[model samples]
Target: MSDVLVIGAGPAGLHAASRALDAGAEVTVLDAHDLVGGQFWRHLPDDRAAADEAQLHHGWKSFQQLRVRLEEHPRCRVLTGTEVWAIEPEEHGAAARVHALSGPSGALRREEVLLTPERLVLATGAHDRVLPFPGWDLPGVFSAGAAQALAKAERVAVGERVLVAGAGPFLLATAASLIATGATVVGVHEAAGPSALCRGWLSRPWELASSARKLTELAAYVTGHLRHRIPYVAGSAVIAAEGNGRVESVRVTRLDRDWRPVARTERDIAVDAVAVSHGFTPRLELAIAAGCAITADRFVAVDARQATTVPGVYAAGELTGIGGMALSAVEGAIAGLEAAGGVIPRQLLAERARQRAFAIRLERAHGIRPGWTDWLCDDTTICRCEDVPFGALSLTEGATQSLRAAKLSTRAGLGSCQGRTCGRTVEEILRQSPGLLGTTTTDQRPIAAPVRLGEFARE
Candidate 1:
């Protein structure tokens, strides 16, 4: 087994591996993607790469540095296309036993490797969270994350004309990516009203100055919007999408302070495609598998050194919280140093503190509101894979008292995706209903990662 085994190859994972190597440890990194860059640093292939590949991303140079250093290090082994299917929790603060498959999933043969590292760092990152609407299951309706991925990695526009709507700053980034891919963005509708934005942003003035670069990035986005002549509408949202086969148009509506739709402010906009994201939900399967303590807010709980409650295990990036890339990199550095048994620098801790305060501001500014569910109609689909509608969920299935009972009776989270697409939304919908007994948080999956049945036979 290696001294350190880091899961994920995103901004946090890449930096963790590099810092661990620098601390004189032989490190092994496992990433599911064929490329090292996680979702944030996703890019085109070398042959199809942009002349200035760095321009497409915000923190491109730093990602390049960390990736190159790790790849070129003698004590480092970077395994792309390696999916960690399970992490067997250990007692007495021992490293967790990690079971993974090394190769493409559809390959003729795949190798299964199990390792118990001396120190394990998990940076599994987060995924786009979408609120369900009437026509969300349609083909042209895409998550903002998937739309941005297609634009950045494939340089392909999702549609000729598009509309971006969501709560967080990520909508701006998604819109920019779409424009870069030559898509005509008609408008961006932010669900959070001006008061919510001010509470999250304008309340803290001096603290924001510490995050000048973040402001600069936001400015760049605004500048791009002005250049593209895309309208930025605040205090509004796309409450419903309507189309024949795929999404052909969306109904936009003005929202109250709590995101409830105003009665007479409904209007429609015609667009070929729509990208929506409420925010991000952390990927917690690996962290939970490692027996880490999760916070009430659903992020992995970590200490000052970025060490989890469980000894020999550390977590960074979005797993710890939904900060941007800069905060993720800082967290990664701290976790690496602590995991490698190296001392953390005072400056590093200071930077992390600064970044974290800004992360809090972002959360306040863009956190989801309870009234979002008011936008849903009876026919709205909650679990898309199983075709479970909001009305269906409201109907009493045999003794559906709790979240588990609802899942068992209605089969909402038991679809092909195993609740990845609709887990959080379903949980919230059931929790809001007074008919449900005890509202549970998101469901945990034991075999979270996908593995070929053939690989299981080989095992």
Candidate 2:
């Protein structure tokens, strides 16, 4: 049994494991991917040259240092290719047991492992939040993060001509990555107007000024945009995609201040593929199952020490909120120290406070407005996994009040992906509906990811 078991190997989990080990705790880190670095530092193929690898990922040096330290730490053990399916909290002072399948996801022979740890840190991270648009279910359409992952992990281009559409700084990053892969990026459409983004930065000049490193990182994206002469469409969205079994072109529309499509502003842009993402939503299933309190904004709520409402269960990174790497590191360090029975330093707390304030500004600037719902036609496939159309989701006035109610009525979130892809769309639809005003909650499940029946039998 380890003193601390961190579920995730991202920046937060890595830092948390290091901190706990520093405090003389036996630390074990588990990650689903075979690599220690999470999506941000997605590892390149081993055959790739070091120079090529360095060119692809930023913060490679920092990640290398962390990886080396963790690997050398005698008290620390990092397990890759381990998918934690369930966390069973024990009563009467028993340590929590983390149930996991140890092997590649689709492997024929996977070992079932139960880890009992005194404290658990969840750094499960966030996933791309996608809004449903017409033809989104077609091939060649993927989330911006998915495009980045493919380029980073597989060294594959999503398409010859790709149009990246989304909101937030991530869009620029994805565009830059796609351009690096020699893809012909037609344009990058952002739903938020430039003025809103400018105001978000202006509102917190101190935070902006402190983010010199972030600005420096963004310089490459700006350079790529200018060099490629890619159209950076502000206050714009891809209203619909058209293709024959695969995306061929997208209809871009000028969005108003509230992100509603403007009339007579639709323009067709030809592209082989479209990458779209609104923002990020925290992966809160494990936290919710651990009985952590959720904030009004729907992220897992944590205290000053990063401890969740549930005892012995702490959360960091995007699980708290999508505050990027720096904030996640700070929160993870604090959580690790506290979880290992060490006092958190005042400086770390102050840093966390500053980063959190900046995160609020970011969230306000990139938050998805409900007006995108206007783009959905009655026949648009909102739940692609279940083939549930927008028209099928008819709620009687005041009849459906919750996400579960809506899901049951339309069978929208019941597919194999299990609402990971379509839950947000369903929630947004219900929120925008005139009769439904109930709070949207994160969907909770017994298993975090798909598990084979044989694996369960082994357990």
Candidate 3:
């Protein structure tokens, strides 16, 4: 049994494993991908030159340093291409057991490994929060994160001409990356107004001033947008995507301060593909299954020491909230030290508080306004997995409703994705529907990811 088991190899997991090893704990790091760095510092193919790869990823040096240390440390082990399906906490005085299937890409008959660790740190990270719009189910419509992944990992562009739309600083980064990969970015439609940006800057002036590198990066991305002639339109959103089979054009709509579309402000922009994302939602399947307490805002709740309500279970990174890389690293270090029975320094605690405040402000500024549902038409597909349309979700008056009941009636969120893609949208619909007793939450399942029957039999 390992002393500590980190469930992800992202920034949070990497930092946690390193700190735990420093405290004389045996650590095992498992990840679904074949590389150490998560999406942020995705590893380039071996054919790419070291210098070229370094140039593409900003956190190359930090990732390299952590990777080297982890590799050299005798007490640490890193396992890639491993999918954890379930985590079962043991009874009193027994270590928790983690069930996973391990294999190379496209390989069958994966070996099953059961990991027993005294402590578990969850840093499963997050996924793109997609809002439904017409033609979103088109072939060429991809999430902004998916587009960036294609460009970074495979050096492939989503299309010759792309229109990126969303509300957040992430849109800027996505646009910059697409342009770097020889794609013609027609425009970027940001739903939030300029006041959001101004508020973020003014409120977090000290945070911005403290990070010189971040300021430089902001300048660089702004310069790229100017050079590429990509129009970064504020107070606008992609109201609809239009095409026969694939994305060919998008209808952009101007929005008011409350994010309601203004009349006669719709315009058509021709593009081969559309990459849209509102923000990120934490991947809380594993955390929820472990019985961790979540915050009112739906993030996993943790104390300053990064310890969850459950003993011997800690969470960091986006699992706790949608903090950026720096905050994730700090939280991971604190969790790692505490999990390994080490003292958290006072200075570290202060830094975590400061960074967390900035994260909260950022989240508030980019919070999705409820009025975005106006973009959805009665015929728009809300749950693409089950082919459920918006018109099918009609709720009866004065009837107590729940998401599960709606799923039973309309067959929504019952498909392969298991509600990861449309769960948030469905929840919102339920909230707005009249006669609902209260807000509905996602149903928990034993297995976080799908597993083949043969693999289960092997286990």
Candidate 4:
């Protein structure tokens, strides 16, 4: 039996496994992808074998270095293209029982029983959160992250004319990348206005000099928009997308202080594609399945140790909460230290707390304002997966609410990309309604992708 089994090979899981191996524990790391680095740095074998190392995505370098270190450790085992379906307490005196599919099928499956290590760290990362509107289900519409992935990983463009929409730092980043890659950016839309900058400046003092450095990136990104002549439309959002088979045009509107759309202020812009996203939500499937306690907002809650309520289980990185890559690496290191039974220094934890406090303030400062969805007419689609309109889902006794209550509501979650694209819109809609906060959680599944029955039959 292995001494430690990390469920992900992302930064958090990699750090945890390294720490455990350093502490003389036998470790095995598993991931659903064929390579490490999770979403931030997804690479295929071709990417790994690329002749131009400098052309490799910056994010993958860290994962590549970690992969080399782990591979050289005789005590560690790395399993790629593996899915852990369930984790349960051991029946015998063993520490825990992990059930996983070795490949695509049940044929080569194994019940990995590990002598529950002193700790288990989960660094599953985060997923894009999108808000739905009219014609969102069209082919050319994708989350901003997906657009980046398509270009960076798959070397494919979703379309030639792309308009990036939504708020937060990611919107700017996506726009920059698309513009750099030869896409004709019609415009960039953000929900927040100049006031967001004022709030950011106020919290900059609290985070000290570090906050200033980060804000510089946002400023640079905005400046890039101006230099590119890509109109940065603030205090606005995409209200509707119109297209035949794919997105060809969209309605953008400026919102009032209360977030209501001004009448006759809507402007239409034609674009072959749209990359829209709000922000990210923590990816907590592994944590939740391992019985970790989730917070009020569905984020996996952990104390300073990065240990979850479940004994021997820990979470780090965006799984705990979304910050950037630096925060994730620091959180992972702290979790690793604690998991290895080592004491984390007070100064280190203090730094994390300080940065985290500032991060919370930043999130609130730029968070989706109240009544933002008032821009959506009753006819606008709320659940793009099922083509369920806002009014149909919002009515007091609507079938929408009924499906949600019965947990039979795939309308919001069952799209081509599953719930990754529209889960937040559903949550926001529900949160707007009274008494609906704790109704459900993201569906916990063993494997996130479809497993072919033939692969399951493989030995």
Candidate 5:
């Protein structure tokens, strides 16, 4: 059996490992979390397992089946609480050398492991992309991802009165989860308006059939919103959050086609908490370290077979693109089968194509618009880690020309996060500036994930 290392145990990784093992390969699935499921299937731990875990998630049963099968498979090794910190490229057709630490991250003792697998699969997934506004750094303002996660995994309400604001179908689900957690949802808001939605979801009606497979889930969220009498507002956003120290209320403003705020259309809404998300940003550090080709749009570049530019390396899931779970799983299956030397079935190819179209629709429907910057005042916090404001970036001021120079001068992305949270936003702020963009990109990090100095010394 050939050694196959899958660098995540999310939906994509699990499917990939299962398919690879079925094709007669030895698979080792490494996940950073304590459990196999990534964020999508995240739930309470076994000790505090939810009595109705299935209620919080959409595909709990299927996830359980695949997860159980992999854990018990003779040719599989599922390593939970293991994080790959770096990938060193090999010169002679060898898979990248993976450097990792395994154990409870907070615990004092953690074991380091180095593996040289013949094949590698990366499904590191994505993080929530929040376009910053004034007072976004406040305590009660939460990213849409964090809000849903708290409600789903911990059964914790973000606030007694919560307002869900963001683009994409995800806002509906977030509102549903908030309501489930006993939060009084003031409303559900979408940044994209009816026109964008029509262009994205209705323009190519035939292609939507591929995505319609999950329409039931969408319908359920919509039904819940209606049943609860939650107003669904479109073409609007929370322009500014306000409070003394934490968020108390937000200024909601109508936006134009380019996402520019419409004058005199702003209104203040009182809410204890604000849950917001514009879209998602792909996690590409592992792929970048593995020397895979990234697209102009910053996603990992993959072909019809899910092969990366680097030999013996494959990519799937959100890193490849912002397609949903079903798309990621299909890509994973294809990558695993091909990596294991199994011929991919024709139906998988068709499904992948359908999913790709759906991703395009998603991009059109709810993707971030350039005019989102209009939401930012000069005093708006750009990098929460560094507490740097928009005016400090000076993208249009022509003071510091390069991204690196600006980051250094203002200490924007050089903070504790190492740019994971604000790097893309800083880049976007630069992109809009035109003259501020430099050869340096915030995407590349020498260390994919955080490591202790001791861990680095061990390596």
Candidate 6:
């Protein structure tokens, strides 16, 4: 029997693995986290740790069930706390060479699995998008998803007063979690204005009931915010943050339809911490390194069957783009069915298409506003890894064109995190500053994570 290697343990990865196993392939699922569920449907220590159904999304409950189902499969093997650093396509043999590291032991490991009947699935999800503003480097600043994780997994409060700033569903989910956990939401700032809801409504009539369901979900969140008396500021941006050491207060302002912050509407809201996001950029290190074609969103581009341009490689979930967990699960199943040489169920394929269409519409309507680069004054830091200032990158020759040029000039990409946090922001700043945007593609590296030298020597 051929072995299939699925590189992720989230819904997409697990779904693909389950399909492969059902089709008689020996499947091994690898993940960086110790647990099976990815960020969306995390497995907390106990059920009591999480909030009631109203506050939390329903997917979390379903993911919990998925975990139990995956565990019962005989053809499946789960490897958690493992990192896939590099992958070499097979030319002579039918198998691909995968190089990875186990997180806890820091040991390098290698596996060569066949590529024919043994398919490769890239379900490596996404990371939160961060926009750099003054004091973003402050100690108390966290991503919106990070705050939910902090409370759910680590059992710690991010802060008493927190600012949740961003655009999209994650912003609402994060704010709800924080408020339910007793954190005072000082203010919620969204880059998109009332136009976002209008666009959502306009699309609903054409999309049938799907659009209405999404609208209702959004309305419920808005109602919760209103009931709690939490102020939701739409068409706004967090221009700057100020504090001695940690975050103290943030400057916010009204934004025009074109995303330019209005000059006269500036206001400063006091808060001990800030949780901000724009959207999510696909975590494409492994996919790009493996030579998959990337789209404008920096997500690994795949066809209807979740197959990448590279043969024998399949991709699913947020790594394809941040379409949420339900979409990911459906995409995963479709990918797995395709990988196993089985016909995708007609119902599942239709569902995937509907969800994909909805995701694209949402992305277009709530697209990142312009003038976000305004947050980064010349003095603001862009590369948090190396503490490189926007001024430094702007001055460096050819750094204004793209991430690749900036990396060449300032060593911006040469960091431990591999520019995951700062890459999108740098690209946006570069595109806006001097009007130099050559091509939109993620920087691909051979190794996604660091590997011990000894392992290489031994090989």
For candidate 3, report its TM-score.
0.95
Query: For every model shown, what is its TM-score relative to the native structure?
Result: 0.97, 0.95, 0.95, 0.85, 0.97, 0.90
Residue-level lDDT for 453 in candidate 1: 84
Give the worst 10-residue stretch by lDDT in candidate 5. Answer: 393-402
Residues 1-459 of candidate 2: C-alpha lDDT, one tens digit per residue: 339989999889988988888788888899989888888888675666346676777777888888899989989899999998887777655346778888877898888878878899999999999888999989999999999998877778899999999888889888888877879899999998878877766675876666566667778779868988998988999999998889889999999878999999999988999999899988888787777889987888998789888889899999998888888888989988888888788998887887787788777777787788889898999888889888777533333576777777777888888888888778767766666656656468769878878777776
User: How does candidate 2 fare on TM-score?
Assistant: 0.95
Model 3 lDDT on a 0 to 1 scale: 0.82
lDDT of 6 by residue, 1-459 (tens): 657788888889888888887777778888878777778755465544555642455456566666666677787778877777777776543435677656564544543222233578889888788778887888888988898787656656699999899787778878877886789888788888888746854655667366454666667778988988888888887878889988898889888876777888998888998998888888887777667888865778999889998777899999887777768888998887777776788998888777777787668656787767765677788888888888988888778877677887887756777777787777666776666866754457677777667765654
Residue range 1-459, candidate 3, lDDT tens digits: 339989898899999999998888899899988887887777675566346666556677888899889978989989888988898777664346789888875467877878878888999998889899988999999999988888888778899999998877778878887887889999988888788767766674777665555567667789989988888898899989888878888999998877888999999988999888899989898888877888898888998789988788999999998867778888989988888888788987877777677677666667688888888888899889998887777643222277767878887888988888998888887788776665557646578877888777777
Candidate 4: Cα lDDT at 17: 78
lDDT of the structure predicted as candidate 6: 0.76
lDDT score for residue 426 of model 3:
83
lDDT of each: 0.87, 0.84, 0.82, 0.70, 0.87, 0.76
lDDT of 1 by residue, 235-297 (tens): 888988888999999999998887888999989999999999989999998888778889988
lDDT of 1: 0.87
**lDDT score at residue 287, model 1, on the 0-100 scale:** 88
* Pairs of residues clashing in candidate 4: 105-455, 105-456, 106-456
The 10-residue segment of model 1 with minimum total lDDT is 434-443
Off by over 4 Å in 5: 395-400
List residue ranges in candidate 6 displaced over 4 A.
45-57, 92-95, 103-117, 206-208, 211-220, 401-405, 433-442
| Pairs clashing within candidate 6 | none
Supply candidate 5's per-residue lDDT for 347: 96
Clashing residue pairs in candidate 1 are none
Model 3 bad stretches (over 4 Å): 47-50, 105-107, 395-400
Deviation (Å) of 244 in candidate 1: 1.4
